[model samples]
Target chain A: MKGLTLSQRVAAKTILVIIFLFKLRNRATRKKIAFGIARIIFALSPKTRKRSINNLRIAMPDQKSDDRIRYLAVTAYQYIVFGVLENFWFEDIEYTFEMDAATKALITSGGPLSIATMHLSCYEAVPFALQKLTGRVTTLSRVPKFAAGLHSVYAKNGVCCVDKSQAGAFLALAGKMGSNGVVCLHSDHFGSDTELDFFQLQTGAPAGPAMLSAYAKTPLLIAYAVLQKDNTYIIHIETVSEFPIGQSPKAFQFAMQAIYRQFESIILQYPEQWCWFYKRWR
Target chain B: MEYNQQLKNVLSEILNIDTSNFMHSTKLLGELSELDSMSIVLLLIEIEKRFSLEIDIADLEAKHFETFGNLASFIKNPLTV
Candidate 1:
């Protein structure tokens, strides 16, 4: 922290203040405060509120009521804030993982696997829980500072992170996956010229998981952790690559489309838990 | 420009736009509102189908999609780029 820039030091201090405040409350009170803060942010920030509204409109055009869509947008904002607040509480809480027997076997086998996940509720917990099942889990993340905070709590919890901004980062991730490591990728964002159909609209979807699985010659899996009413998280994991992994770009497109279809289904099921403020379709 | 008619056809279909006025010098990335992230991806897929070449994500750049001519050249010979 001595050599850090002023902005970084301020950011770190803000995070510390959040954690200290979070530490003052029990789980139930913390959740209530988090939800209240989210509501305030949603009400205050017109940009996020509008973006969420527009995203939901594009994602579900036939919903037929603006009020319903607006409610979902506000709840989505709350969920995102709640997710951030819960990051401070991950170490003390126990998350339940729900998957089929085959899925469990695939994760427990500790073989090479690539997981594609999104910004769903408590999405960060998927990798944390996976590290418990397998001995190691690696992830490509963009934000190093945020990850550093989580690493302090889950210190050496077998989660290896590589900054995605560096050149040849994908090669490094592929090398890790080549050695039978589980690499978790946040794949719900847009990438140039990597198109896939999501919610019947065309948008750029990351082809990393599909391409990495093919390169690594391992099964590609999709997982998401959603929050329940009882202040607990339930992680759902599934395998998407049922047939032989194809190396062609066409194969990558097909695999990604299938993955987004699954993502859309999950979002539709838990609309409030997903991050709709993101310009996903744009 | 004549060699790019097939390219224009594929682009129009994938992007759901009328290619009546799109010249080889037409700006794509910024000028066209239809060429957002999703259409850009479908544009690559359609280019792959029309040209029988597979374009990797690494081969993609803003310059390659700046204009219709640039896009056509990339589709014609992606590996050399």
Candidate 2:
């Protein structure tokens, strides 16, 4: 086995201690620490500040003011920090949803279900909450190279993460649908195999979920967890039927677009909560 | 009766541009000027909605989007033929 160098060992020990300290802190303390980190990031990173402003400009073309943009950028940074902290504190937190009977019926039905989720406030918390509320839950996510420990935490919580980079991951995911598992996936990010036309721009977005659903002859449900002013999340669940069973690929892409349009509407409503740090249009 | 022309008409309407100005030879990105990344995505959505087709990511190629005529032809009778 390869041994760690003195610096590497020290860094590893420091990170371990930080993680332990973070876990030991109360929720309020975590929020304060996250907010402090956000403020520091805002003060230090000029590029991120500029990018946030540019993102808000594109998202809201009509709203033009330096002060407003700056405020939005700061708020977005705070949200990003809070989101990260939420991931750590998610296991202890609880959420309440006011889903309609129709939505509940679709969720309770023992069949393959696909959930379309965007990067919203405490996005990870939604699935964690769902696993607590509904036992069957899985999420399509790219495995982070540095976050092997985090993956184990997610696994412990019953949230299955599918590495998007794997060749046959989509196929395997499609096969899993037969067991009536709830697969939650983000359709916003750009992917090499994806066709363009997202967020009023030409960029690749993976069509795997839509294609998998079409192939499996399962239902695709659109759901998003948005944070309200009072810091509670409202999970909006809606079923879009534009993409019928056995429809052609183009029809499925169109259906995906309709779903994306709904996501855009949600992002517009809460621009600060959206993950603007990502190169979304690119 | 060719599906290529019909597809071109649909593309023109969605983009709010004149079909008469578009040619089979005109490229989508640089040549059309109006066909940006967002437009391309919107066009794909419109195509899927109108024609009931789903496009795979691996199937996309830059050359496929090079010309209006090329896109029209591809959509009219995809390479699957």
Candidate 3:
């Protein structure tokens, strides 16, 4: 079979939407159908399947049974599908956060604070919900060219998305930080220029957040919204420390090392929920 | 006062591997499967923490981390004459 053209892919998506609208009244059936479609896609992609299994094996080495690993892999696939669906219709979703006073205080502090999050289940909603509760939010994100419509929807919902590919994006983010705006970034993803670490065998992670905080003289806040079995969310927020203001680049790098240490702790705690299939430690 | 031993200790801690079988000539990337991209970054961070120095990503080369001795030498004398 030939590869799908851009217009054909769009048309296929349109058909899926039409089917979704036709089954809108039957929400449970729609969810089941979505999950079933996801399972089919998951099984068809050999590379994704292999990567998912490898990730499961590495993360849960103690679980020796193939059945267990298979279960986790399937769950991971379901999560990706459901997450994409949810993100598409984020405005209609309602989530509850078990936030402590300290978490709330950190957001309300009105300082340029940096949040380091991973690509976990419902990761996008975490910031969206927070901005709705607290106020406007600024987040560094790599905007997908094909998802322009979805990106606009997120923007309409008040998410200040900064394109990571552009050099000026970093400067803009730093300027926003200096002006006492909240800047949230996903620190776990690998990049071409990023430094590698334990999350994967060979990974490259962008040092933008660290660089921004150091340059802007802002406090770094480590935040993640962990999905619970009960279908509720826990927004884990902690004020790690402030970057040494007016310090040398070396001092800033040291401060970033400390921040990444804290990030490693969180990723280790919930390894499965992370985007492990990513070539993170590569 | 050999820097190789210090480098070994740091590697052992960072990679969470026993250094008993490790030698100065041990290849960091290909030979040791544990010294992956993530581990490499973590090792860099740990080195920076321990030595109080900064290393740019541009400064890194495969040769710099090819062997334990190379890494030690780089850390000991990062300046190029």
How many collisions per candidate?
Answer: 0, 17, 15
In lDDT terms, how accurate is model 2? 0.67
Candidate 3 - CAPRI tier?
incorrect
Q: Per TM-score, what order, best first? A: 1, 2, 3
Per-candidate Cα RMSD to the true structure, in Å, reads: 8.5, 9.9, 11.8
**On residues A1-282, what C-alpha lDDT tens digit does candidate 3 reach at each position?**
035578756865675575557346443454566668878987898888788888767656677899867766776676656555566666656567654677567677766677766677668876787678767577876755544555565786688887766533554565566556677887766554344444334445566555555545566666777766655567777766544232344454555455566666776676546665555445
Better lDDT candidate (2, 3) = 2
Tell me the tens digit of each residue's lDDT in model 3 across B1-81.
356666778889978998767676867765676765445645766777677776543245557777777777789886321
* Candidate 1 vs 3: which has more lDDT: 1
- The candidate maximizing lDDT is 1
Global CA lDDT computed for model 1: 0.77
How do these models rank on DockQ, best leading?
Answer: 1, 2, 3
Q: Which stretches of model 1 miss by more than 4 angstroms? A: A144-156, A242-244, B1-81
Best by DockQ: 1
Return the TM-score for each candidate structure.
Answer: 0.75, 0.71, 0.66
Q: Which stretches of candidate 2 lie over 4 Å from their true place?
A: A1-16, A242-246, B1-81
The CA lDDT of each predicted structure is: 0.77, 0.67, 0.64
The TM-score measured for candidate 2 stands at 0.71
